[model samples]
Target: MRRLPLAILAIALLVAGCDDAGASPAAQGSTAPAASAGGACQLLDFGMVNAKLGLDLSVAAGASLDNTFTCVLQAKGVSYPDLVLAVSSTTIDADVFGDMIQPKNATAVQGLGVAGYQMPTPAAGKAGPGVEVGWLAGNKRIIELSLRFAPGTPDQRAADAVPKVVELAKLIDLSSL
Candidate 1:
């Protein structure tokens, strides 16, 4: 019985390996992909991220569809900043942010980019620890770097993550778009 399942599994693995997938997801060298429509984000090189964040990062995988392009960066398979970062274009203007209900510790930040802000987790009780930094590139686009820590994470650590994400946002070159 065990041999039967092993044979079936082996055949499935062999078939998957033979599938004609597209080119490897790794971005070649430092050249970035072209900006998508509506003009919100540009493909960023891993070295650029490492230089900005002071950590070695490499692309784990990527995809491009129409006006959107996304590349995931990781260090030894770990997510960048141990969380998530998104630098992409959107049709909506920055004024949409005016409707946001600021969390307990959201603070307006100046000059991380055209404009920026940091949002920290609430100070009390049990809530997921998260921090986000949002930056505006004029009115047509906004870039955000965010991190979510394990529940019950120390408030100070959540507070600290916000600044680091803001630093990462500053590295993006909006003019290149």
Candidate 2:
């Protein structure tokens, strides 16, 4: 009879312990990363810099201007137009913004400096069919960094381009900019 009582007590303790184990950190009211105030931008860490950008997304109603930096390249007699790094209140869409540009198969990478921040190689690729787009995000923002290579360019050149984008992403200041 004593052994039966001890066994019952042990089972009770085990059940109590299981209840504690099932409680998640969130359920315990743990703190989460701080979200942006306007819910427009997110912060990102790309190994070298820290920054935030707009996501070009509108959550509720109003349309806002995209906050982005851009540069153009004219190499090897080709006009690579429409290179833009713009941030919106809701989305960060970086792309080669012009229509006359084409993806060049040549693997040429360049960097730009904006107000002391190095803009990452804007996500490079074609838009559709021959277009490519890349995106990265933080808890508070969505970053869509893209590029359009001059036609006849292979994707391999574009593969090496993402790190530059990561580098540039580090410069965004989501809290204020």
| Strongest candidate by TM-score | 1
How well does candidate 2 match the true structure, expressed as C-alpha RMSD? 23.0
Tell me, by lDDT, which candidate is best.
1
Question: Which regions in candidate 2 have their CA more than 4 angstroms from the true location?
Answer: 1-78, 91-142, 173-177
Runs in model 1 deviating more than 4 A are 1-42, 64-68, 79-83, 91-93, 101-105, 112-115, 121-130, 148-158, 173-177
* Weakest ten-residue segment in model 1 by summed lDDT: 1-10
Worst 10 residues of 2 by lDDT: 54-63
**Local lDDT at 168 for model 1:** 64
Estimate the TM-score for candidate 1.
Answer: 0.53
- lDDT of each residue in 32-143, candidate 2, tens digit only: 3212211121332211211221111111111123332221111122223122232322222223211112123322223321111112233334321122222222322323
